[model samples]
Target: MQATSRNFKDNAHRALEDANLQKAMGFVRTGFIDKRKAAADALPEFEALRDAARDIKNHTLANLDRYLERYEAKATETGAQVHWCTTAEDARETILEICRSVGARTATKGKSMIAEEIGLNDFLERNGITPIETDLGEYIIQLRKEPPSHIIAPAVHVTQDQVEADFRSHHKALPADRSLAEPQQLVAEAREMLRQKYLDADVGITGANFLVAETGTSVIVTNEGNGDLTQILPKIHIVIASIEKVIPTLEDLGVILRVLARSATGQEMSAYTTLSTGPKRPDDPDGPEQYHVVILDNGRSAMLGTEYQEMLRCIRCGACMNHCPVYHAVGGHAYGWVYVGPMGAVLTPSLIGVDQAGHLPNASTFCGRCESVCPMRIPLPKMMRHWREREFERHLNPPAWRWGLKAWAFLARRPRLYQALTGLQVRLMGLAGRRRGRFASLPLAGGWTEHRDFPAPQGRTFQQLWAERKRAA
Candidate 1:
């Protein structure tokens, strides 16, 4: 919805202080990270698949225009209307127009970040059309009236107790004394509640994980079967996706699929991997009557040839966020955007501009966990560094930060001076903290020292030790 990347520091601070958030974040470490690692380890060709996936995306992006035309021709031939939108506003209005024309009262939605990016729900509501989120995670956040905290696991920030409360609060018709202590119970309750919404929906909307040009198919992979129900039961089905999602062939999709689920949720394949080519054929048993594909570019076309183009390779796996230390500490809402963590840090700036999202790139510690786990092998750290450089160059950073960088740059250019200054500072700090072997508080490092002590430099500077080792060798 609204861009709050500018308030990331404040958001992060609030998140860190939240006990429920801290408890929920435990799942990221204990569940996702370990499961993903095990899943990757089980696959003999996982790394190779990642490389292939990256190459497939690169090829698709390079010939994106050609593939888009091919996709349109094939989809149109298959009785699907393909709408190309250059902006979020255009995409929102187009979906609304389709709904209005059909006299739609409500639409069922699968988990779609593209819809969030375009503010589709609010737009539809304001236009007198109800948008119902059917994906479990999406439905949870919808009930809470909050944006998704994570891309794949939208309600990951929500705990079991909180969810039980939300269900009790929202499902007023349901018995209050029912036992909702378990996750299965919660799922069953939500499933029963949403099943009616699916049946009553006039249109179904979903986001494509991959758009196949050769077959003119839109694909969605989900552990829950909500996406399948969302698209099939409604009279009309609409696939909303960004331009970067288009791939040239089914073979390429096959390669990417080998890595997407493993990297995202540690499954060989999600329980339901649904592909819709077009509206129902005459012989089809059950399907939508109308099929529409809305491809929104937003600002992705501008990133095609730039250094940031590597970011387009992202599969929205959520691996980077799962492995991210910063995300683990404060959770996803701290990013203040639809996308979160390393991918969001780079992509948000591109979509929403670096000025509003300047703090996102700076939020990282650049430990490179994100790049290490990325299925597409996107160099998230490098892209974030580029954003930081852009921020500095554009003078978008605060004066204190600009001055600090300038001061560091001045000394960095001179080898001897840099070494001498650092050596002196290290010696002074080393002596000062020799007794404790750490500093609980430091002049300009309050942020670091606030949580834990800054370890004291042991003795000589690292350069001195390196020089001695080099000479000995």
Candidate 2:
């Protein structure tokens, strides 16, 4: 949860060298992409749904203040305490105060990026409260004492063998010969381990995927039902979410839900889509005694009406990262923050200072796959470009980068000179590399050439080819 985004290049290099991580990332490449495409193809109205989802979020963001007020009022009416936090520190302190007030010794947690963003677990531990992650992926990384590598699939960077090892190390009470070779066996083991924790927990903490303004409901979608137990069994349930998660109605929630599952996990719906309106009523058989919603603004309120405002439309479905080549190559930890992939590239800089996270926006290959697959149709590439422009304008970039851009700009302004220089260089490079049709090493492009050979220019530049074709025609 600390910002090592400043060391992204080093992180990426280390990730590339991590053989286990590389093997684990193979799951990402094969797991999400094809499934998402098939799911989208199966639905005749998928594209239309995407547009509707986008409009719904845009409308909600435009009237966010009204919806937030309504949500607070409605939630309070339903006997849920609504706490507004302007900063991460405020949110953390508020949650801790709630825990302390309840005399909580331990808290069970569902997967919450908002919690991760605020460094909640460590804060709670330091304050004498143990926070237990019950989500399977979250549980895996929690035992490893590492940050999540993927938003939806937190332990995606870890291989099965590594997981088996981690389980063997952490679950000492379990038999040493227990079969963890199968994933289901691992799940069963974790389930057995966590069942007791749920009953023992005094407080349950979760993040809301959507906060319904009309009903004061906090919605979470998960493949496993851990979120249900995490929020239900404890004496108290606390929802931590950002302000932008509030939407106008259950109707809007339904629309977004259709796209959210399909985009995130390629399912029509998750195995469990749980919605909690408030605390237990007298008639309810099993539910928390107290319900609390902690809405954190952090830096989101400042993003409104700005070029970055569209980013609030993100559903955290993680479709962008699933399709991003850079994310595929290095995985999420290289991103050095809670959020990862294309969405993270744009959002991290806005939440944390651009100065601290400036490298994230530049991590992209600008393939535009992220935008294409985005259910909300967020223009990720455009936002990243905006970040890059801001970085250059603020002189946050190194002097070498600035000088290189200036040199390119000077040459670009003179078309003939630019073309001539490029043409001559291309010819010389082509002649030099004619033997192998590639360059194993290049003078200034060591980064590109170190891992793989650079393809030599076959002939003249595109402009020259275009001119020749026009004259011939």
Candidate 3:
């Protein structure tokens, strides 16, 4: 769970050369994009749903304190414990205490990014408690001792062959000759191996997609049903979520859920959308004995009333990264953190610091595709630009970039001088590259040209062409 965000350039370079990663990244394009398009097209009210979802979240955030208080009162009424954590340390320690109170030797876990954000697994392991990941993708990455590359698809960076190898290596008791050539076979193996873990687990921990205030309910949406098992079978159920996850009402949650699955996986609805209010009632046959909700702030509260508040609307559908060209080229590991792609680029800076994650904001190409496809209508590219401005303001950017931007700004302030300088530079470059029409390598721009050639100017600048058109008219 240690961040390597500072080495993003190195990580991205390595990812670019990794054939396995490239092959796996292909799924990001064909799988999520087409399915989301089809699902959205099928639902005529999809756009309206997105707008409704955004407004619901905004309202909840505007009165977050009132909603959280109401949620806590209702949850407590149902005999659930609600713990508020202002920091990661507080959240981790709170979870450890809960595990200790239950005398938990091993805990079953559903895929929770809040857990990753707090380094919960390692903390639990260090404290002599075994944390078992039941979600298939989480289980795969847990076995490999790697952080999730994608939010929903943790093992997206891992290939089928790698998964098969990991299963063989971990499941030593199984037959060596067992066929794992197909994905279903691999799933069966993982399920069989994890089934015992679920039965033996003393406690179960999960993350909430939305914490409803009206009913004091924690909602988890999934396709595998692992989350349901993780939260229900164990004696104690612990729900870990960020503070912003709270919504005003069940009706508000319904609107968000309508778009969440479609935006994430192209499904009209997830196979399982489990809601747990608290512990089992006397009449209930199957449920946990106790329930606890740990809401962690972890720098999210600092985003309020700022330009970055729009980011809070994100439902983690991952539509931005699915369409991102940079994410496709480098994969999620290059972001060097839990969140990845466009959402990661903006959120990482806020959660971690802009100093450590400055490169993430700069990684985008300003394509704006992320904003267009986002279910919450988050302006991802705009937020990234905001991060860049913050980076520049804090003097965190490299000296060369600082000077380059300064130089550009100086010329840009004077229209005539900017035009004259660009015109001269363009003519010189045009003459030089007239033969080939592109430069394979250019001074001070090797980063751009290293992978491909940079197209040369076609003789005149846009201003000159516009002037000519005006004269002709």
Candidate 4:
């Protein structure tokens, strides 16, 4: 909700030291990675589908104004109100006003990152309205009064034992002796608790995975089926999404869907992929009476024509983060914001300011795993480099870093000087650490050496090796 991205180093340090979090992170290291690999490997057309998804997103963004207007007209024709919000405050106020119109005392919510981005839950509580998260992962975090650690799996950072404890602590009406040793037991308990809340809710709010401009439909894919209950049981249904979610046609949605589940959770499809076009028709058995769509810009429009535009293609499948080494080490909470990992590293700085979130872009190892696995082929590593450049240009980095870069640049301009200094330094280090083949500590490299030994220089620099090879040839 709030930007503590500036304190990412401290957050990451704490996360690394946390025993519970480390145990929870084991699920991340073992679960998503293998499942995704297997799923992707099984589908021969997976890569092709990724390319098509990327093209569709790019086309829609290029003609966003036209598609947005068409989507509004179509949705309005179905008796649904579409509200355009240019800022987070505007989006939050608009949602509150809609809740007020319905006299909503309590609202049921499906998982929505945009809501998190806008701080909707706290805002609703401050206005005397209660918001209940129905999605199992979302529900768990809600009870703990914490933000989601992962996009799709909000409670992934929480262990099963911790969840059992949370359920016992929060659901006091339930039997304190009830066994929650298994995940199924926990789910049943949560389901029983939320079943009544769904019926009592005056409003149901959800986030759209994809907004179909051709049909004016809002789509959500979930394994738990809680999203279905959240939207249908309430009298009023509200959809909150960002502008980049809009796609041109159902065919395009189909192409994206083919890859979404596999990339996210290794499923051919989620248990439920629900699409809502509008409110209930006269003949309809059960559905919401009032339908509203709140589309928030929240600084996304500014990214349209820039190099960072590739990031808008993200489907929130979270493949990048799932495969990211940094995320696996420290977990998402260390990012200190709604989005996390490679996608967050690029997108957070864009939504917030580079000055506040500058450290995020620098967190990467430049291993290129994120870009390699991205469903939309977003150049994550390159974008992070761009942000780093922006930070340096703006002087957002500390003075020591600036001076270090300047010193490197000065030597880099003269090839001979750069090679001479590096050669001398490597030889000295090589002799010093020849006994152990590594250094326990090194000057100006405490961050690396403090964690683990720095590998000693084996021989001459790359330039020297290249020169010798060229001479021999």
Using lDDT, give the best candidate's number: 2
Residue pairs with colliding backbones in model 2 are none
lDDT for each residue of candidate 1 in 21-106, tens digit (9 for 90 to 100) = 99999988779888899999999999999999899988889999999999989999999999989999999999999998899999
Cα RMSD to the true fold for all candidates: 1.1, 1.1, 1.5, 1.4
Tell me how far the alpha carbon of residue 347 in candidate 2 is from the true structure, in angstroms, after superposition.
0.5
Please, what's the RMSD in Å of model 2? 1.1
Comparing 2 and 3 on TM-score, the stronger one: 2
TM-score of 1: 0.98
lDDT of each: 0.93, 0.95, 0.93, 0.94
For model 1, name the residue pairs that clash. Answer: none
TM-score against truth, every candidate: 0.98, 0.98, 0.97, 0.97
Report residue 54 deviation for candidate 2 (angstroms).
0.6
Model 4 ranges with Cα > 4 A deviation: 465-473
Candidate with the larger TM-score of 1 and 3: 1
Show the colliding residue pairs in model 4. none
